[model samples]
Target: MITQTISLYNWTNGVIMIAIFGLVCLTLIGILINFMMSGKKKDKTEN
Candidate 1:
Protein backbone atom coordinates (compact mmCIF):
# COMPACT_ATOMS: atom_id res chain seq x y z
CA MET A 1 0.00 0.00 0.00
CA ILE A 2 2.77 2.44 0.90
CA THR A 3 4.76 1.50 -2.17
CA GLN A 4 1.72 2.04 -4.36
CA THR A 5 1.19 5.49 -2.87
CA ILE A 6 4.81 6.40 -3.45
CA SER A 7 4.65 5.13 -7.03
CA LEU A 8 1.57 7.24 -7.63
CA TYR A 9 3.43 10.28 -6.37
CA ASN A 10 6.23 9.59 -8.86
CA TRP A 11 4.24 11.52 -11.43
CA THR A 12 4.66 14.63 -9.27
CA ASN A 13 8.42 14.08 -8.88
CA GLY A 14 8.18 13.30 -5.09
CA VAL A 15 7.67 16.90 -3.95
CA ILE A 16 3.97 16.44 -3.46
CA MET A 17 4.59 13.06 -1.89
CA ILE A 18 6.89 14.50 0.75
CA ALA A 19 4.42 17.26 1.57
CA ILE A 20 1.50 14.85 1.72
CA PHE A 21 3.37 12.41 3.95
CA GLY A 22 4.52 15.15 6.25
CA LEU A 23 1.00 16.47 6.72
CA VAL A 24 -0.35 12.97 7.24
CA CYS A 25 2.26 12.17 9.88
CA LEU A 26 1.64 15.40 11.68
CA THR A 27 -2.09 14.85 11.71
CA LEU A 28 -1.64 11.32 13.04
CA ILE A 29 0.66 12.50 15.78
CA GLY A 30 -1.73 15.25 16.77
CA ILE A 31 -4.59 12.78 16.98
CA LEU A 32 -2.56 10.45 19.19
CA ILE A 33 -1.63 13.28 21.50
CA ASN A 34 -5.22 14.42 21.72
CA PHE A 35 -6.40 10.95 22.63
CA MET A 36 -3.81 10.61 25.35
CA MET A 37 -4.71 13.95 26.85
CA SER A 38 -8.41 13.21 26.77
CA GLY A 39 -7.89 9.89 28.47
CA LYS A 40 -5.88 11.51 31.21
CA LYS A 41 -8.54 14.14 31.72
CA LYS A 42 -11.25 11.50 32.01
CA ASP A 43 -9.26 9.52 34.56
CA LYS A 44 -8.70 12.56 36.69
CA THR A 45 -12.32 13.59 36.58
CA GLU A 46 -13.45 10.15 37.72
CA ASN A 47 -11.45 10.35 40.91
Candidate 2:
Protein backbone atom coordinates (compact mmCIF):
# COMPACT_ATOMS: atom_id res chain seq x y z
CA MET A 1 0.00 0.00 0.00
CA ILE A 2 2.79 2.41 0.83
CA THR A 3 4.56 1.70 -2.43
CA GLN A 4 1.38 2.27 -4.35
CA THR A 5 0.91 5.63 -2.70
CA ILE A 6 4.46 6.66 -3.51
CA SER A 7 4.06 5.63 -7.13
CA LEU A 8 0.88 7.63 -7.43
CA TYR A 9 2.60 10.73 -6.09
CA ASN A 10 5.45 10.34 -8.52
CA TRP A 11 3.07 9.91 -11.41
CA THR A 12 1.21 13.08 -10.56
CA ASN A 13 4.46 14.99 -10.16
CA GLY A 14 5.66 13.86 -13.55
CA VAL A 15 2.42 14.91 -15.19
CA ILE A 16 2.62 18.36 -13.61
CA MET A 17 6.21 18.77 -14.75
CA ILE A 18 5.35 17.80 -18.30
CA ALA A 19 2.44 20.22 -18.37
CA ILE A 20 4.63 23.07 -17.20
CA PHE A 21 7.28 22.27 -19.77
CA GLY A 22 4.72 22.19 -22.58
CA LEU A 23 3.31 25.55 -21.56
CA VAL A 24 6.76 27.10 -21.49
CA CYS A 25 7.53 25.76 -24.94
CA LEU A 26 4.25 27.13 -26.31
CA THR A 27 4.90 30.56 -24.84
CA LEU A 28 8.39 30.65 -26.33
CA ILE A 29 7.04 29.73 -29.76
CA GLY A 30 4.38 32.44 -29.52
CA ILE A 31 7.00 35.03 -28.62
CA LEU A 32 9.20 33.98 -31.51
CA ILE A 33 6.29 34.20 -33.93
CA ASN A 34 5.33 37.64 -32.68
CA PHE A 35 8.88 38.86 -33.05
CA MET A 36 9.18 37.55 -36.59
CA MET A 37 5.87 39.09 -37.66
CA SER A 38 6.78 42.44 -36.21
CA GLY A 39 10.16 42.31 -37.91
CA LYS A 40 8.56 41.65 -41.24
CA LYS A 41 6.23 44.60 -40.77
CA LYS A 42 9.14 46.87 -40.02
CA ASP A 43 11.04 45.75 -43.09
CA LYS A 44 8.03 46.30 -45.29
CA THR A 45 7.54 49.82 -44.00
CA GLU A 46 11.24 50.67 -44.42
CA ASN A 47 11.38 49.43 -47.96
Candidate 3:
Protein backbone atom coordinates (compact mmCIF):
# COMPACT_ATOMS: atom_id res chain seq x y z
CA MET A 1 0.00 0.00 0.00
CA ILE A 2 2.77 2.40 0.85
CA THR A 3 4.52 1.64 -2.40
CA GLN A 4 1.37 2.28 -4.34
CA THR A 5 0.91 5.63 -2.61
CA ILE A 6 4.46 6.64 -3.35
CA SER A 7 4.11 5.66 -6.97
CA LEU A 8 0.94 7.64 -7.30
CA TYR A 9 2.63 10.70 -5.84
CA ASN A 10 5.53 10.41 -8.21
CA TRP A 11 3.22 10.03 -11.17
CA THR A 12 1.28 13.13 -10.22
CA ASN A 13 4.46 15.12 -9.72
CA GLY A 14 5.71 14.17 -13.16
CA VAL A 15 2.41 15.14 -14.73
CA ILE A 16 2.41 18.49 -12.98
CA MET A 17 5.94 19.19 -14.12
CA ILE A 18 5.09 18.36 -17.69
CA ALA A 19 2.03 20.58 -17.57
CA ILE A 20 4.05 23.52 -16.24
CA PHE A 21 6.68 23.04 -18.91
CA GLY A 22 4.05 22.99 -21.61
CA LEU A 23 2.52 26.22 -20.29
CA VAL A 24 5.86 27.96 -20.30
CA CYS A 25 6.55 26.86 -23.85
CA LEU A 26 3.15 28.03 -25.01
CA THR A 27 3.63 31.41 -23.36
CA LEU A 28 6.99 31.89 -25.01
CA ILE A 29 5.56 30.99 -28.39
CA GLY A 30 2.72 33.44 -27.91
CA ILE A 31 5.08 36.26 -26.99
CA LEU A 32 7.27 35.53 -30.00
CA ILE A 33 4.30 35.52 -32.36
CA ASN A 34 3.00 38.77 -30.91
CA PHE A 35 6.36 40.43 -31.36
CA MET A 36 6.62 39.29 -34.96
CA MET A 37 3.09 40.49 -35.77
CA SER A 38 3.68 43.90 -34.22
CA GLY A 39 6.92 44.26 -36.10
CA LYS A 40 5.13 43.67 -39.38
CA LYS A 41 2.53 46.28 -38.54
CA LYS A 42 5.19 48.82 -37.70
CA ASP A 43 6.93 48.24 -40.98
CA LYS A 44 3.69 48.60 -42.90
CA THR A 45 2.87 51.91 -41.19
CA GLU A 46 6.33 53.28 -41.78
CA ASN A 47 6.18 52.40 -45.45
TM-score per prediction, in order, is: 0.61, 0.70, 0.69
For every candidate structure, what is the RMSD over all alpha carbons to the true structure, in angstroms? 7.6, 3.8, 4.1
lDDT of 1 at 10: 74
Off by over 4 Å in 1: 1-12, 43-47
Model 2 scores a C-alpha lDDT of: 0.88
Model 1 residue-pair collision total: 0
lDDT ranking from best to worst? Answer: 3, 2, 1
Off by over 4 Å in 3: 1-9, 43-47
Pull out the clashing pairs in model 2: none
Deviation from native of the Cα of residue 2 in model 1, angstroms: 26
- Best-first order by TM-score: 2, 3, 1
In terms of lDDT, model 3 sits at 0.88
lDDT per residue, candidate 3, 1-47, as tens digits? 89978887687789999999999999999999999988875455766
- lDDT of candidate 1 over 1-47, digit per residue (tens): 89987776575767877899999999999999999988865455767
Tens digits of lDDT, candidate 2, 1-47: 99988887787789999999999999999999999988865445766
Off by over 4 Å in 2: 1-9, 43-47
Better of 1 and 2 by lDDT: 2
Model 3 deviation from the true structure expressed as Cα RMSD, one decimal place: 4.1
Please name the candidate that would achieve the greatest TM-score relative to the true structure: 2
